[model samples]
Target chain A: MRALFAFIAGGLFGSGLFISGMTDTAKVQGWLDVFGAWDPTLAFVMGGAMIPMAIAWIIRARRDTPVLGGTFPPPAPREIDRKLIIGSVLFGAGWGLAGLCPGPSLASLSYGGIGHWVFFVAMLGGMLVAPRLSIRLDRTVPAE
Target chain B: MVMDWVWGLVGGLLIGLGGAVYLLANGRIMGASGIIGGLVDGTGRRDAVERVAFLAGVFLLPVLLYPLYTSIDTHITGNWGVLIAAGLLVGIGTRIANGCTSGHGVCGMSRLAPRGFIATVAYILAGGLGVVLFRHVLGVI
Candidate 1:
């Protein structure tokens, strides 16, 4: 039952990504191109996505358990640590380089681009090594 | 415009609504990275079914729905070197940060999480710099 809801939600999310032009790598790159020919379409997408999310947060303030009988998780930590900063930096670099982020990467699999498969596999490999690499990063740059 | 902003907005609303449902139903944030991350790293073994179900829907629906609408192109670069390098960076970065654009950018920022704001800023800035470095300077991307 819970999985069913999750499945439906995922379907909605992926469909949204597809319609929003997020799965289009070129559009993503255009949005990132602050200095060049900037496309403002992503701003609308970001704004559109945030509206319902903000409403959800507002609605949550009045409730305890969700409509589905689950406990609402606590807020994320407030600390702005090195891990968050550095990790975001690296992620952004990759996002700029490939114009692919996690959601769109997964969403683009059906696009049948060899680059997508290669990026997906490579992403998994990177995820596999992340624990060790992050430990090393912490030693060099420190973690929260 | 290459594409319409109306579609972007409509799509975003669906994405947000999906996330809202996930939060309201599962009491979990709808982040692609965290969901997939926990599954991949074995930390989310208990919830493996949920994660996989979510992924299955995200991945498989497009196969059926995409052709129904229209055949879309990813327009991703053919440079394998850049693709590999970027994939690794994204994987490692999102893992370490524990969020991505969907996770931190949408869910966090919408709720006014400071970490989300910072992460979003950092990534956007870094992404722009990367464009400058790769496209303008080195001509790699």
Candidate 2:
């Protein structure tokens, strides 16, 4: 049952990405191109996303248990440390350069865009490699 | 313009609803980065059914929608090396930060998690600087 809901939800998310045309890497890359004719599409997309998110958040906050079952687990707490800074910096650089983050990249793979395949492979590899590095370094940070 | 807004809203709702549903049902937050991260550490089976379904949806959505909207265009200029390097960096970032923009920006923020707040602010600042670095400083644009 939970899996089914998640599937439906994921489908909704992917459809949204597809409908917003975010699967098109050029459009995403355009947002990063601030000087050579700026594309405000990404901003608009962000704006569009915030609306429903805000509403859903409000609803979730007011309730103790969700309509489905358990109580909200709430995210774990942590301080902003060196790992946070470096990781975020890396994320920003990658996003600005590639114009596709993990979620959208995964979403876009359906388009069969070669770029997505490259992005997905690299993303999976990163997911694998980052953990081994963490284990090797004896770091205990949760993979965000 | 209308289509764009509609799609964006739908996508947001889906994520929010999915997240809410996931949290309500399993007492777990719907964070892709974390789930993906956990999948690496052998916790994959803990939520095996849901995780695989969520991931599959991520890949299947666009394929279903392509026929309805024909204006899609995906192009890239940079070489594969750069893209791979970027992915590596992002992987490291998510691990260190303990959340991605989605986890912090949506799930965390929704729960008013302080860490999420700080992480998100940092994310925005870094994102801004990265754009400047790539477009202006490096002249990639």
Model-by-model DockQ, in order: 0.83, 0.51
Q: Show the colliding residue pairs in model 2.
A: A87-B93, A144-B98, A144-B99
> In candidate 2, what are the lDDT values of residues B1-141, reduced to their tens digit?
556556655666555665655665555666667777667655577777778887788678777767876566666545777677767766666765667766776777766677777776776566666767766787663
Interface RMSD of each: 1.0, 2.7
Candidate 2: regions farther than 4 A off: A61-71, A75-78, A135-144, B1-10, B137-141
Per-residue CA lDDT of candidate 2, range A54-141, in tens?
6666666677776667566643675556666666667777776777766777787766556667766877777777766656544655
Error of 2 at B86 (Å): 1.6
Question: What digit string (tens of lDDT, one per residue) describes model 1 on residues A15-63?
Answer: 8888898988888888888878898888888899999999999998889
Q: What does candidate 1's lDDT look like per residue over B1-141, in tens digits?
A: 735699899999999998998888878899898888887788889989989988888897677778776557778899999999999999999999989999999999999999999999999999989988899899987
Q: Residue B55: error of model 1 in Å?
A: 1.0
Residue A43, candidate 2: Cα error in Å is: 3.4
Model 2, residue B62: displacement in angstroms?
1.4
Against the true structure, candidate 2 has what lDDT?
Answer: 0.67
